[model samples]
Target chain A: MTRLTRAEAKARTRERLLDAAARVFAQKGLAGASVDEIAEAAGYSIGAVYSNFGGKEQLFVELLQERANDRVNRAAEIIAEAEPAEANGALGRLLVEVADKDADFAPLQAEFWLYAVRNPELMETYAERMREPRRLLTDLVARSVPDAERAGELSSIVIALFQGLVRMRRVDPDSVPDELFGRALRWLFTGAEADEEQP
Target chain B: MTRLTRAEAKARTRERLLDAAARVFAQKGLAGASVDEIAEAAGYSIGAVYSNFGGKEQLFVELLQERANDRVNRAAEIIAEAEPAEANGALGRLLVEVADKDADFAPLQAEFWLYAVRNPELMETYAERMREPRRLLTDLVARSVPDAERAGELSSIVIALFQGLVRMRRVDPDSVPDELFGRALRWLFTGAEADEEQP
Candidate 1:
């Protein structure tokens, strides 16, 4: 293994801890999951998790922040390339890219939602931790469709549809086709598939 | 109300128990939820819950069965209408109609999923619950696209997208417009919006 500088070592350890936390959370869920199990998964001691993040819930919030950030950062690139009325496919592609990039992401979304439902504490922290997706998509939709308000409506539904589809597919692969996420949105954004329908 | 016969009372009481259980499960979730709470919610004594369902887990399974049977009963009406090409849109409309008919339904769907995550034992049951939605969509996609197997990639994605949209909209009303659900599918199933795209 390559030797790391002090900063690199810190980053690596943080990443390892986060990785461990995801598996622990997935396996045990929020209420049943513990810091010790998370530490064990990361190949570190419990202290490492505490040292990096104050507690189990804090660690979970950190995990949520990282994931939410990753999505926004990735989406920004897709949006940057988009132009007025020219982003018909760009918006759809960005979402498809997300669905295709990580098979495990949808489960985390569902798991976090389950967390939010069970614990009222997480619900209030949502805008603080996870409002970017809605905000960004709203802006993207406004840009892509005319009549910004009406267009935004379509965009929001498409987004909701996209998210719902991901959760369903992750939970049961046999039931939902993998690429249906983008195809559905493509139909919404471009209105390209409408004519393909049989009369 | 007319006085019920013995069997009628038994059936009525069971229905009340299930309704109460649904509310408790939706509010507190399956793991954190209790049998006593369910019984109380149903306006019955704790002894009644045990007498009727045995325990919390068994109550949960029965809840799943009841929800499944309810949907199956709804699908029976749709099965008689053999316009498979139009069936996908029909399913989307059904979801909307559900929300319009009873605002409580989607929240309950979210709760059912929360239970699925808290107890892995519920995963199989949840998957079974999802089968009808998939079967409905797949059969429709097959009739419309004719290359459904080859288009498996896109099909999976649309399912996820549909679930995501439904859940997101159900969770937040302002962010998701009411019309997009039906309109998007109409566009997807027919070419209602074909003129909007640039040639």
Candidate 2:
């Protein structure tokens, strides 16, 4: 087995704790979860959790930040790699796939979001964390839909649509067909003219 | 006070219980709330709650159903009253206004939604309840956007967009400006060419 250096060991411990936190938070919710439970689940001491994350709320925030960064990076890569015409479709598929795979995480996300919104101090940080994904969407709209006069507003609509669809799909998956995402994206990108060509 | 009919008294009690449930659930979430607490909050006995709604879960579902019905009725009124050219904008304004006025209820709705999503049986009931609003939007889109080939799909997108903007606004009110709703509604109703005339 390869021996880990001090920094690598610390990094591994942090990752494990985050993984454990996600499970604990998802199962019990933010208010119901505790640092001790998270540490125990991660196989670390309570003191280790405090030293690494300061506290439960901090740990939750960090976990969300990491996940958001991962999503934005992956989406950026997908959009960059695809042909312009196919970029939106590829991105939509990626989103639907992620929503399906991360179904369990949605509740945890809604919990933390409510937690942050209820607490004014945390709301700022949560909003800041959300900016990365919004920015990426905005940039994509500007680049791909040059005729879209209000790219920023369109981006907001797109983000809101995706978020809403995810929630709606959780309750009734049949309501939000996977193809719906592509159709919405195409309409937003091209405009009303696309509807005329529909068979 | 005049003597009350039994049916009138029963209706009054049910309304009061629902109001209390909204407050209790909003403050303590669905799992954290109790039948006794809700009953007491409304100045009624636990028996009243059981008789009116059966239990906590049933009360929660009924509360949601009542609220959803009220919203759809109000939206229908708004659409029916507006000029054809202004119907979409009027509906969008009503949505944004309600989102602001009922900001406190958002978290409670989200909590129950999460609760229902996590439980299979509850998911069916919740999805069924959601259909009223979805149907209203579908009908609105079909009437307003004659050229929209996929009226059902457009309605889904519109509902999802409104749901999403409400959530995003809770975390960061400035991010989802009130005017954005109107803009997005116009685009969805009219199509991409609307962007070209932007100043």
Candidate 3:
């Protein structure tokens, strides 16, 4: 192991503990795993987990919600940089970037969604956070279409397509091609132009 | 109450039980709720839940998986009747129909999806069953596009789009729009046409 200064060692140890807890919680599930086991996995003492997160459930929530927020925030920041007119392509890229972007967090998220339903308070928190992504898309849709409420059926389809792509990529990565998102982007943005040229 | 034959009464009771269970499950969650409460909400005895479904977990699975299969199968049959070339359009119709078709079951399915991850065996069952619809699309894809492997990317996008739509509709029904599904269908089936219209 590389030698570490005191603060660096503490931070690294905390990160390790979080990683171990995440893995155990994800693989064995929240109810199935124990704090002691998490400590062992992290090569830390049980006191480490307690010191870092206080307890398992809170740790689980922090690992999931905070991390998801970080990701969405990063993706949204990328979207913020996009031209208003390029909203469709931008949104698609953001979503695709999110979907195929990283695998480490995806399964944990998949596990969290499971937790969200099984736990109602988490569900409320989830529902609250869910609105943020939708709100972002709604704004993007407004920019691209200029008359979203009037855009009628199109807006919902827009959200659904992004959601569908995400779900599919999760279940089977190979099935969702790299260009897949680009095609949807072009169509949602370009309308008849993208629609006709697809596949 | 109208008097009914044994079969009719049994059917009505089963339906009532399912509806009540969905509400309770939605309110209390998959893990938190018990069968007695569901039975009480249905105005039936505990025996009713036990006799019809045996337990809350099994009942939850039945509602989420078996019932969903039946609906999708029926939807598949309808899609099968459409012209071979128009199958994608048929699928779009199928998805739109699902969005509008029944409100109760959709939310339940979404809840079930979130809940399944907690139980890997259930998740596997779900993941497997979820693939059935994808298989339908895969076969349809193989037929419509001679180079199915090449179309893998497109296929996944379409599949994801459909799954995502179902999810969104449950969250906010009005936002999804009526023609959204059809539009996606038209675009997905007429891929090249969709693209050409874009650029």
DockQ of each: 0.34, 0.44, 0.26
**Share of native interface contacts recovered by each model:** 0.45, 0.59, 0.37
lDDT of 2 by residue, B82-171 (tens): 887887678668767767887656777787687776677777877887776777767776774554546677777887887788888878
What are the runs in model 3 whose C-alpha is more than 4 Å off?
Answer: A1-74, A82-156, A171-174, A177-179, A186-191, A194-199, B1-28, B41-44, B47-54, B62-65, B83-97, B141-143, B150-155, B170-174, B189-199
- What docking class should model 2 receive? acceptable
- Candidate 3 lDDT over residue span B1-60, tens digit each: 778999998889999998898788755556557788999999998999988887887888
Q: Model 1, residue A39: what's the lDDT?
A: 90
Which ranking of candidates, highest TM-score first?
2, 1, 3
TM-score of model 1, chain A? 0.71
Taking chain B only, the TM-score of every model is 0.70, 0.81, 0.69
User: What are the TM-scores, per candidate, against the unseen true structure?
Assistant: 0.67, 0.83, 0.59
lDDT of residue A147 for candidate 2: 46
Could you arrange the candidates by DockQ from highest to lowest? 2, 1, 3
TM-score of 1: 0.67
Q: Give model 3's share of reference contacts.
A: 0.37
lDDT (Cα atoms) of all candidates against the true structure: 0.62, 0.76, 0.65
DockQ-wise, the better of 1 and 3 is 1
lDDT per residue, candidate 3, A99-178, as tens digits? 66554454455456556655656776765565566666566556545555534445456656765666555555555665
Ranking by lDDT: 2, 3, 1
